[model samples]
Target: MDELIKYAKENRRLLHQVPEVGFTEYITTYLIYERLSQTNFNLYVGDDALDIDRQVGLPSDDVMANTYQRALDYGVPCSFLEKLHPYKTGVVATIDTNQKGPHVVLRFDIDALPIKESNEIEHVPFKEGFQSKHDGEMHACGHDAHAAIGISVATYIDEHIDELTGKYTIIFQNSEEGVRGAASYAKKGWLDDADYFLSGHVGTISEEVGTVGATATNFLASTKFNVELFGQSSHAGSNPQDGNNALLAASAIALSLNTIAPHREGATRLNVGILQAGQGRNIIPDYAKLECESRGETTQLNEYMFERAKEIIENGAKMYGCESKITVEGFAPSATCSKEMIDIVKSATVSNDAVKTIVDEVSMDASEDAAVFINIVQENNGKATYLIFPYHLKYGHHHPSFDVDEAVLEVAITTFINILNELK
Candidate 1:
């Protein structure tokens, strides 16, 4: 157990030093592959594990090339990068005990946020010399810790193979920030045969280092989309009338999207996070792009909000004589944890010495791509649940100074191991 703790902490810090976002996790993928290669699990990486046709929200070709080059410069071998070339970045490992028991699937997300890390002297990572090396990326959401726990769990399973029954499938997912990536594997039937599916996140509900939440309920359904408006460019000061003014159309759509009426049936939300238009101060912008999202307490409500937003965007573009296109970057539907699965988590937590409290239920109140996988497993009549490992945090998730108490890693590791034991 002490060795697992040491392994978890070291790998967490190592992952923290290089934060990559979404589908561009080149260096991150290579490191995960290298670590798991020493275990007994049969590994399926990148192109082999995920369905390429199901990928969403990939960056442009130039961005992919630059990130791939960066991975090379970071000393990652081209041989590994070649396997994940052009936007394939994740791993799936399976070990079949062939002992006549349930098949368990565990998921861990490995993507980072685009936020830059704080370099304040008091920041733990900065002081410990493990802050992110990349300028515009950081694991502000504790995914580094999640990935570390996953690696440790894989090693633990290998070491304790004699005592465990059934089979284990561990998924290291990428591009979870926008509720993307999981669908690729889920659509490919990764969780179709799963008898028990388990996944968790760190520190959103529980407030203490030793607390564990057995069930994360009421996940909001969400849709992330990008809208592009095209128009002719002209001089603003002279021939402004000749241009269709895509920037104006974008501004109108952004304002109209926020005015969408809330559904009385449930909670609803809409936001235009990014809107880029107008290349210069005096130029009538010919192109505009807006990154936006919609959320609801239920799937039906989310569709209500998204459909309304789409109508506004299309009409707003037509009003300005600009052509409009809407593309779905990512999506996740809402799901509830099964009582059977919730009991399984509680049973596992009760035996863990590192766990101080067991939360029967907590509201996620947010979107998670894991819901895609969870829904797929449930649809096939398998039980599934999402757990939460609470830890002390200096800042909320997605903040530049966000850091978790390393002590929580022990709770996470033991809880997962105990859960496996319960399945027997």
Candidate 2:
């Protein structure tokens, strides 16, 4: 147990230093493969795990090139990168016991938030030398801990296969930060044979040591998108009438999009987080990009909001005489877990010595891509549930100073092991 804790912490620390976002997780994939190479698990990646055509909001080719080179320079070999190149860095590892039993799938997201880490010495990550090495990328949301726990659980399941009689599957999912990656895996029919599905996030519901929360409900369905507006450019001081300003089009859309009325059926949230336009101050901007997201308590409500927002954007673009393209990069449907799945999590938590108490509380005020996986599994009549592991945080999620206590990794791994043990 001590060794496992040490292993989990070390893995978390190592992963923390090499933060990658979404589909460009080359270093993450290579490290996972290298560690699990000798294991008996049958791994699935490349075209087998994802459909790149369906992938949304993928980084540009130049970004991929820089990311690849960055990982290579960080010690991830080209051979490993080559294996994942076709798949765009998604991975799924499976181990079957051959005997007739249930098919279970465990998912863990492996992506970092796009935020630079705070360099203050008081921040634990900086104090410990585990600060993110990459600029504008950090595991501020604790996915690093999630990845370590996922790998540790996979290793344990493989080593103890003799004691289990089922197909144990672990998915090291990428691009989950924007809910971009999970749908591709789901679209590929990975959940067709699943009898049970399990996944979890590290915080938000659990804030103290020795506490665990099972079964989140009322998850917000969401859609992430980028809208690019195009117009003709001209000199600012001369013949300005010849130019159409895309920046005005995008700005008008942002202000109007926010004013879209909320639905009475459920909660709705919208934000335009990134809006970029213009080149030189003296030149009329020909192009502008707006990155935005919307969420609702139900899928229908989200669609309603998105459709209205789109109309506003379209008309706004036309009002400014600019062409627009709205691209839906990712989406997650709302989900509620079955009682059967909740009971399984409850039983596992009660039987584990590490978990002092199990809380049934759930906060669904936010969105998670795991909703995609859960919905797919449930659609096929498989029971699915999401858990929340409790821990202390030095700063709130997505903050530049965000850091989680290393001990929660223990709770995460043991809870997973106990659940597998119960199921087997």
Candidate 3:
């Protein structure tokens, strides 16, 4: 465990140095494949043989083509990889034990956010010299850590493959931030035979160093929306009223959305992240657009709030005499942890004395596509649990300065290895 921790600390520092964003994580994926292939595990990449018959929502061929190219460029063993519809780059590797036992699936999401790296010297990326090449795109979230930890776990399991006694599948998923990746995976029945499934995030909310929290148990379900308002265009000075004023309608809709927030009780959240309208001040704006999200701890509450939001937008557009279009970009169902699975993870953490604290409460407001795995598992009568590991961070997620303590990476590696052993 001590050696593994040390290795993880060093590797995590290197991963932090080179940040990649979302599905285009080329260098990051290459590094992961390079490291994992060195172990005894059988590796496969590029979804070429996936049972599309089981796929839920089908993505375009162009998306899948780009995904395959990325995987191939990264050196993932793609010859045996399965292809599935709707998933651009979903890679699955199975560790078959040959012995009879329940199958388990573990998922790790490898994607970065769109934020520039902080220039601070103390910030890990700045010091490491692998900061993002693409401006405004960085691994501000701890996804680099997630990918590294996934590799570490796979390596550990591969090293002790002979002693393991069940089917273990490691899924390296892409595009979790868009929240559409996991749903596509689920629709394809990727986890149809699993007895237990697990996924997690690191450094989500503030907690003591090495702490592991059962976050998904209380996480909120969420929906992403893109709203477009259209109106007739006319000269602002000569006939402002005749233009219909789509910008005005968008502004009114944004303000009225605040009213929907307080209507839901108990930890409801809503935010309008992006709003764009108009080209010139002299011209009456003919079109306006908004990207918004809403969430709640339960599906029913989330849906209720979402409905109210729709009503607000509809009435606001009517009042402004503009046409409104609402499109759902993505959606993730709520997550609830299984008591039995939670006990397994908790016991592993306690046995190692890895962290200073282990939080039992739900602690994250941000949504996760990992929640999709929980939904699929439960629907298939299987159990799933998602956990969080706390790494001391100087800045919050999505911030350019966001950085994590490298030492915590060791704790996560140790915890994951122990859990895999115990579960086996």
Candidate 4:
């Protein structure tokens, strides 16, 4: 591997070893900030930059404390975390040359999944000794590499700001796995005043190394929610009749939610991933919690499903003489990529023949919070598109064996730089 590729790969491994989930990406954030902090670009992190009100799916205090201490053990400076103290995490750095041109924003997600990684001797990371150190958390997604690319772009532009016109903004977003984070920045006006906005996800649609998804299609809208059911606790054997079992309420709600009618006009989905409640076999549980989500091809369709979900959860709780509390954690809006933005990405990739194919469009039925940024930017008369950069993947995203060829990081860095310069 060339020096540049090797550098990027090393950075990815370092980040991969310290995987964090959602808004608690202190270790990942520090690495990027450390690499780009030396540049003249103005940097923003945490509370001031990310709207705390809009941030969702954050870890509990105990979990956040453990991760923060781990980040310190991993060599992240205490002074650094102190700067972002009041908030969890987010990143926005701007490089301005005082030239007259469109303001361009480049975004990248930097977070991991809550999955225990494989420890087999044959696994590349395990063999190479850069595997995740945190149990039950791993960089099953390519966000580690994406953060490296974001730093690379920041470094390159900071060095060449004199050669370029216009202002460039780089965002190292947090908690993208559950479609959270982007809205926090957007609602705070962090993405406003953009002439163009662009983002890329590596190896998602197809694993062909030379292909690039210039424009994504069929993006779905979704909502993530958390519910808690409350009931009176009592001894099972002696006071069974006096108990209102929250577990029963939560279980019934989960079943009813899955049976909600699908939208005839478009696709609709409901899933309840987590259900927790109970004290012991001999005691009637008074509390139960659930994590659930709904999705649809369009925003309206998703709204339709969400309404029914609330009803089911509420009525189901009432059936068991319990009360339900539901909170909407995150939301993603369906949207289509702009043709003009795709044209710019296509133009950038076509310059290199090694890029065998540049697809103008590809369907991404999976919901993405980035769509919120795209839609808001477009609404303000700015152009935007989500680029799907491909690579050869050993396993599907979010799997225990998930891994990608590191060689694609260089291509991503170069393509992003070229696109930033070409967005006129």
Candidate that scores best on lDDT = 1
Kindly list the per-residue Cα lDDT of model 3 for residues 161-200, writing each as its tens digit. Answer: 8887788888877667857567656765668888888778
Among the numbered candidates, top TM-score falls to 1
Compare candidates 1 and 4 on lDDT and give the better one.
Answer: 1
Superposed model 1: Cα runs more than 4 Å off: none
TM-score for predicted model 1 compared with the true structure: 0.97
C-alpha lDDT (0 to 100) for residue 28 of candidate 4: 82
lDDT tens digits by residue: candidate 2, 1-424: 6666677889899999999988889998877776667689888777877767778888888888889889889988777787677437968888889977899999988999889999998998899898999999999998899888888888887778888988988888999888788878877777888999999988764378767777877889999999999998999898799999999889899999999998889899999999999999988899999999999999998898899989999999999899999999888888887678667878777867778777775776888888988888888898988988877765788999988888788888998888888888
Q: Summarize candidate 1's per-residue lDDT along 13-68 as a digit string, tens digits.
A: 99999999998998988899899999999999877788878888988898889999
RMSD to native for every prediction?
1.2, 1.6, 3.7, 1.8
lDDT of each: 0.90, 0.86, 0.72, 0.85
Residue lDDT tens for model 4, 164-282: 88888888898888888888888778678988888888888556777878888888899999999999999999989999999999999999999888778999988999999998999
lDDT of 2 at 26: 90
- Error (Å) of candidate 3 at residue 135 is 1.7
> Whole-model lDDT, candidate 4?
0.85
Which regions in candidate 3 have their CA more than 4 angstroms from the true location?
Answer: 1-3, 6-14, 40-44, 49-87, 261-265
Give stretches of model 2 more than 4 Å off.
Answer: none
154, model 2: CA deviation in Å? Answer: 1.3
Question: Would you list the rank order by lDDT, best first?
Answer: 1, 2, 4, 3
**How many pairs collide in each candidate, listed in order?**
0, 2, 11, 0
